[model samples]
Target: MFFHPMDFLILIAFGISLWAQFRVKGTFNKWVEVPTRTGASGAEVARALLDRNGLSHIPIEVVRGTLSDHYDPIHGVVRLSEAVYYGRSISSISVAAHEIGHAIQHKEGYKALTLRHRMFPAVNIASGIAPFLLIGGFLFQALSLIGLGIIFFSVAVAFQLVTLPVEFNASSRARNLMIAEGFLYNDEENGVKKVLGAAALTYVAAALISLLELLKYVMIFMQGDDD
Candidate 1:
C-alpha cells in the first residue's frame, strides 16, 4: 500500500523482463519458418550431437510446450518441445542443439553446470518459503524473520547468478557443435545465433529480475529494522 524507491526498481526490472520475453518469442517466431538445408528435425539434430559427443545412450523425448526443450541431467534425457522435436526449421535446430549442449556439459562435468545442479535443492527450498517468511515477518514486525527471508531469497538470487554462465556456455557449445557437426552452414548459422542469442537474453533478464526482487526484500527488511 506504500510506495518506496525500491518499488521503481522492481517496476523497471519487470518491464525489462517483459520486453525480454517478447523479444525472445518474436525472434524465435521469425526464424521458426526458415528451413534448414539438411532438413533434419530437432530430434535428429539432438541425436546426432549427443552421439557425436559419445552420449549415444541419451534419449531425446518429445515434451509438450513451446520452447520447453531442456536436458535433464538427472535422468540423462533430452526433452524437446513438439515443435523442436519434429520441426526441421532453423529455430528448431538451434534450440535442439542448445539443449544438447547441456547434455554435453554434464558429460564433461562443466563446473558451472555442476554447481547450478548442486544448488538446485537449496534454491528450491528457499524460493518456496521466502514469500511466506517475508509476509509473516512484515505482519508480525519480526526483523529476524524478515532477515531470514532476505537471506533465503538471496540464495535463490545467487543460484540465478550462477546460471548465467551455465546457460551461456551451453549456447556457446551449441553454436560450435552446430558448425562442427555440420548442422548449419556458414550463412544458416547466423539464424541459429539469433535464436540462441535471443534465448540468452531471457536468462539475463531473469537474473536481473531476481536480483531486483532480492534488493526489494533487503530494502523492506532494512526499513523494518530501522523502525
Candidate 2:
C-alpha cells in the first residue's frame, strides 16, 4: 500500500517537512546560547516594539510549551513561551520580534493577514471533515464524494498558501525593525537571521505538505475515475 505511485509525492513532502523541523530546532538551539547585546528578554522586546508602534493596547502574555509562541489576533495578545518570555538570548529576541511583527500587521490591516483571518473559519471546517470524506469516497468508490473532498481540502491548501506571505512579511518586518531599532548589534544579525529563517521554514514546510496532500487526493480521485 505504501509503494503506490502517488505515495512518492507524499514521501518527498514528508522528507522536506522533517528536514525543516530539524533545521528549525537545530538553529534555535545553536542561537539560544548566544545572548543578545541589548540584553532584552523576549517579552521586553515585544513590549517595546508594540508600544512604539502604538500597539501598546495589545498585551504580551507568557504561555506554556516550547516553540508554541504566536500572536492571537482575536485577543490582540502576543503570547510567548516561558523561555522566550524570560530568556535574554538571540533566539528569544528574534522570536519575540517576529510575533510582534504579526501584531503590527493586524494594526496596519495587512491584506494577506486580513485574508488569512477571514479564511480561518472555513479552513477549520474543511480541514476536519475533508479527510473522512476522502476515505469514505475511496472505500465506496464514490467519485463525486471524492471530488467534494478535494474541493473542501483545497480551501485548506489555499489557506496555507495565503499564510506564506503573511508569515514571510512578518519576518521581514521583524528583521527590519530589529535592525533599524538597533535591537541587535552588528555582530548579532547573523544569529537573529538564522533563528528567524529557521522559524520561517516551518511555515514553508507546512504549506508544502498541505499542497502535496491536496495533490495526492486529486490524483487518487482522477485515477479512480479512469477505472
For each candidate, what is the lDDT? 0.90, 0.89
Clashes of 2: 0
Model 1 misses residue 209 by how many Å? 1.2
Residue pairs in collision within model 1: none
lDDT tens digits by residue: candidate 1, 48-146? 999889999999999899998889999999999998999999999999999989999999999999999999999999999988888888788788888
What is the alpha-carbon RMSD of candidate 1 to the true structure?
A: 1.3
Write the residue-wise lDDT of candidate 2 on 79-158 in tens digits. Answer: 99998999899999999999999999999999999999999999999999998888888788788988999999999999
lDDT of 2 at 142: 86
